[model samples]
Target: MGERIASWFAAGHRPLPWRAPDFPAWGVLVSEFMLQQTPVARVIPRLEEWLARWPTPADLAAVPPGEAVRAWDRLGYPRRALNLHAASVAITERHGGIVPSDVDELLALPGVGPYTARAVAAFAYGSRVPVVDVNVRRVLARAVRGVGEPGPARTNEEHALTEALLPADPARARLTNAGTMELGQTVCTARAPRCDSCPIADACAWRAAGYPAYTGPAAPRQKPYAGSDREVRGRILRELRANELPVPRDRIAQLWTDADQLERALRGLVADGLVEIGDGGFRLPMH
Candidate 1:
């Protein structure tokens, strides 16, 4: 099954920039940060622009962190930009501007968590580590566990299951890692999986079990954006991004009608270190 999935991905995976043969590890790190919660289509252009402007960790580390936030440009979860910037600074200062391949070293960097650490080690350095994203988890649940959906994340178990499926050879293990993710992203999608087109369909336990409906605790759903504090935050950000100088407090207040919601968003942004209040007014942090 692993072999089949690797073969399937090798034959037809999308030509994303980070997947290119000559792509730098720095590019992979940037892509992983930008791709969080953002769709691939939106990430491609932003990734390209980010790499073009700051080709190395040292380059990004040279600039103000606010530049990174400004470059984030509606990616949502603006804090990831700060994390990426801080990580770049750490890499430049501690690792001689090189993205670390060791999972421990990667995890120590700002914004690099378990999944991200493994992903960079596997995908960027071909380190033979299991890289399970949401997509890969879905693939595992159906193909091996005979379930329609994975239950709430149990990190250790996910790694163990993915590791058990990996090939013995390092190169083959890398292929399996990439292929499983591709299979999940393209074929074994969360909604409306294409069982007929899946390369591992013959071996899929879920197919053999007649695709039972998932009865596990449901994945948490995102709240609606309309009239939410997030909407207020975005409006405030847009206003700040549009202006070179700090937006006046009154002008910032005019963007959202709900004063309480706007205040909450502003306070949240400041608390998150994404925004700052000063004598001039409210603005993106620039130190």
Candidate 2:
């Protein structure tokens, strides 16, 4: 299955910039962070904009945290920008502006958890760590375990399962990571999987199990954006991001209807490091 999948990737891999030879670790790090939750199509434009503005970790670290937050644009998780800024600063200070190749050092970065650390180590430095995100977990579950879907992947078993399939060759490991992620995104999708076109379809145990219906507990319901504190927080952050200086509370108040909710959201941003409280109102952090 691994060889077949690798063959598929060798035949038809997309020409993304980060996959290029001499691709900087900073570029790979940015792509990994941006690709979190956000789709690839959207990440490409935002990533281009980001690299255009701040080409390296040192370049971004030279700026203020607030600027990073604003530059995050409409990406839903604004805190990620703040965390990225912090990570950049750490990289610049501790690693001499280089993204660390060691998994332990990479994991020590502020925003980098297990998945991001492994991804950066594998893709940027050609290491052999398993890059098992939700997509990879789902694909592995179906292909290896014959499960219709894996439960939430924040588990030890999921990590071990994915790691066990990694090729001993580093290059093959890198290709395997990309292939699994690509397969999950394109073919072994969450809904309406393209089993016929899947490279490892013939070897997939789930398909062999007659593709039985998932009888596990249903996924939890996501809260609506409307009337939620998250909505108010986004509105406040958007207003602050648009302005270069501190925004008055009254100005932010105009963006949201509920006063208390707006205040709570604003405070939440401050706590999340996306905003700072000062003399009159709120502002982005100084570099």
Candidate 3:
């Protein structure tokens, strides 16, 4: 299965910039952060722009963290920008501007977690580690475990299973990790999987079992954006990002009528360090 997946990936995987052999580790780290909870198509251009603007951790750390938020520009979850900024700072200060190859050190970065740390180690450093994401988890559940879907979150068993399935060679392990994710994303999807096109379809346990219904805990549904506090927050940030100067409180208030929700969103943004309120009214944080 791993060999088949790797062969399919070699023939069909998209030519993503971060996947390039010459792509810097810092670029791969940035791509990982941007790819979280965001679509690949949306992240490509933004990731390119971000890398062009700040080619290294030191370049990014030199600027105000808020600049990262502004550069994030409609990525939806703007907090990721702040997290990336903090991680860049940590990388610059502690790791001497190099993204750590060790999973433990990568996990210590601000906003990085088990999955991300492992991804960086495997993809960026070519470590013989399992880099499990939602897609990889789904693929493993169906292909190996005969389950219709993986659990809501990653488990230790999933990690061990992925590691066990990996080839002994580090380079092959990297390809397998990427290939599993690619297969899951393009063929063995969450809904309406293209099993016929799957390289491992003949061996897929779920397919052989007639695609049984998933009985496990389902992934949580996302809340609607319309009339939500998130929308109001985006509007406020958009207004701020467009302006070089701080926006007037009244200007921000005009974006949303619900005073309580708007205030709550503002406070949340402030607490998240995405926004600042002072004599200059509301603006993206500086310094």
lDDT of 3 by residue, 1-287 (tens): 78777777878688888788788899889999989889999999999999999999999999998799999999889999999999999999999999999999999999898888998898888999988998999999999999998977767988988888788888877888999999889889988899878899999999999988989888787899999889989999999999878898988889888999999999989998999986768889896
lDDT scores for all predictions?
0.88, 0.86, 0.89
Ranking by TM-score: 1, 3, 2
Error of 2 at 266 (Å): 1.1
RMSD of 1: 1.0
Q: Can you rank all candidates by lDDT, best first? A: 3, 1, 2
lDDT of 1 by residue, 1-287 (tens): 87787788778788888777578999999999987789999999999999999999999999988789889989988889999999999999999999999999999999998988998888889898888889989999999899999877878889999998888877778788888988888889988899889899999999999999889897778899888888888888878777768888999989888888889999999999888887688888787
The CA lDDT at 253 in model 3 is 85
Which runs of model 2 end up more than 4 angstroms from their true locations? 218-221
TM-score of each: 0.97, 0.96, 0.97
Per-model tally of clashing residue pairs: 0, 0, 0
Model 1: ten consecutive residues of lowest lDDT: 1-10
Candidate 2's residue-wise lDDT over 1-287, tens digit each?
76677678878889888887588889999999988868888888899899999999999999888888888888778878988999999999999999999999998999898899998999999998888887888898899989888765556776777677777888887888888988998899999899989999888999999998888765566699889988888888888877877888788879977788888888888887778878688888775
